[model samples]
Target: MIKKLTILATIYSLFSLSGNQTLYAQDKLEVDVGGALRFNYNLSSWKEGQKNRGGDFGYDMFRVNFNSSYKEIYLNAEYRLYSEAFGGGFLKQGWVGYHFNEQDEIQVGLNQVPFGIQQYNSHNWFFNLTYYFGLEDDHDMGVKYLHVDDRFEYNLAFYKNSEELTFGGDSESSPNRYSYDVVGRNKEVNQFNGKLIYKFGDSIKSRLGVSAQYGGLYNLDTKETGSHNGLALHYEMNVQNWNIKLQGMIINHDPKNLPGESDEILQMGAYGVPYEVASDFSVYTAAVSKSIPVKLGPISNLEFYNDFGYMDKKVDRFEDSFMNVTGVLVSAGKVYTYIDYAAGYNHSWLGGNFVDDFSVGNPDAKWEARFNINIGYYF
Candidate 1:
């Protein structure tokens, strides 16, 4: 009788281990949790006496990403817990799509717009002038198709409303800062973006691409309509341990009525500007970086980079602006840090938070300095 009981116990133990293995094989789900904490020590000065020096923090949130695959269908979702302005939490990216092989896919939801570059070339965390114009690091509610092969890579997208914008009013519930939109008055409608890049050469890898965007803005109050369109050309190359990138674009804004419109009325899209007529503008950006093979303590790599940007608004009484930045980047596993010195004149878009000249009616075009130390850690 004792021998019979031992045999039964052995059978039970083997079956339990086999069942656990079967469950693991049938339910193949992958989950990753990662986030970043960004801190900054800034000393910035703009107009005389308009200066501030202090510590700042941003995007300090925890994120969870989930993924699962069933044959040709793939699912992805991400959620974040961070600072909240409106009622609900912020949604960075969430999409479900079909994989047409390993190189192509189509996704629908909030995704990055394929405009100039996927991620602009800059060591500084603030990005370049294009971001201020709603072109860089800008994501919207849209449908996107992405394809990549040996010859070229492409992205085609169609967006709904131009994300939410804060409209007129000093009411405590202003949503302008949250959403990079106008005072809730002018909203972009029927927007489309397309980008394509072709790669060639074996030894010297080079890529060139052109991008375009077309959209319309509507003023809810006056029922006025405006149109915006632009074209951009970009080029990049990799040489040894150095990388070089360049991009140029032209953008135009055409409103229904120019001078006849309300003088002090809040204009949508373009910030700190009076829409007098159809104005054409241009922006040029360039950057170069070299990676040095040196390690210090926890630092695994060191890089030195320089970034420059220039903007020209072909309008009377409006002066052109330019910005230059030089910085050193340190990478230690999942942690990265940048120490930079930025100086510019009338370049409000490139200025740091405390050195902004956007509010000044007419900037004196005087050069100012920003000593910035940005540190970020990811897990």
Candidate 2:
């Protein structure tokens, strides 16, 4: 109840101030509401020798975004409804921000952690392996400072807690789940994230950036404490209608105390215990995309893309994993679609093989392929 009241108060204060300021200069006030409706059909190969066989239609996502601005003050929020069995309405993002100048801004509340490429460059709606490791398109509650100019961009942030977790019988993550950050541990305490990027060239510009994250990982079971740190180097370039990107990252999760001579590792993410450990792992990704002129019905543009990714874990009997995705995107006004074919091997933990279900007996060590299509409209 107290938390709810505080959130309400903050929202009320923001609106009150915005309304008062906008009244003085009503012409500067702006309000916009937008959202998307998505549908998906997937054909997945579960085992080593399987054909594309299941036919299911899902009302994947319905999102509503609201944005209001009055001079330097702004409010941005989005709510989403998913069609999954365990789905309902939730806040995807909400923030209040103040702009000091064209190049400087500060935002408070739940915002995206400025890590890795945002929104991702993937044909699949699920993104890639980096998401599972909390490296791509992840959000947290924090205060963020952003500075962007002609040559450089800077992002510095501090977060109170990590992503929210659900518990008990109705919990999104149940016993021994293998998706999302359901470990219930590894809460962020005074977490700090910083990123810097440099842009060069004119027609063929290169975007290069280095990012780092460091914070405490608290355990819910033992009330013990741990720490996790990550470093990444990312580079992207666009030439004509073609765009290319590459990223590499190293992450370490170190427990404050470990049993003597235990030789145990603290694993994170959907892998749960015994598989994911308090060790270091590396991920590398590369992707290329090109826009081509194509007209099919209302489709006026098409984009072809390929994404390659690999992850290596330093554990015995655990083979390295890789994913290769090739697909095309079709666009027509507010309508967009994706047709992708993805194949992978030995990425039981870090890839799409474990995406839908993370049960104990699920096939994780087998080769798999999937054909996915997503259609959506913005309104």
Per residue, candidate 1 scores C-alpha lDDT tens digits across 114-224 of 888656645565566666556676656678898989999999988875444343432211232212333345556668889999998777888899999887766555577
lDDT of 2 by residue, 152-245 (tens): 9989999886545463332322212222332433354568999999999999989999999988766554467778788999999989998888
RMSD of 2: 6.8
| TM-score, model 1 to reference | 0.77
Model 1, position 95, has a per-residue lDDT of 56
- Model 1 / residue 347 / CA error / Å: 3.0
Error of 1 at 79 (Å): 5.8
**How high is the lDDT of residue 147 in model 2?**
93
The lDDT of model 2 is: 0.65
* Ten contiguous residues minimizing lDDT sum, candidate 1: 15-24
Error of 2 at 69 (Å): 0.6
How many backbone clashes can be found in candidate 2?
5
Q: Which lDDT values do the candidates have, in the order given?
A: 0.60, 0.65
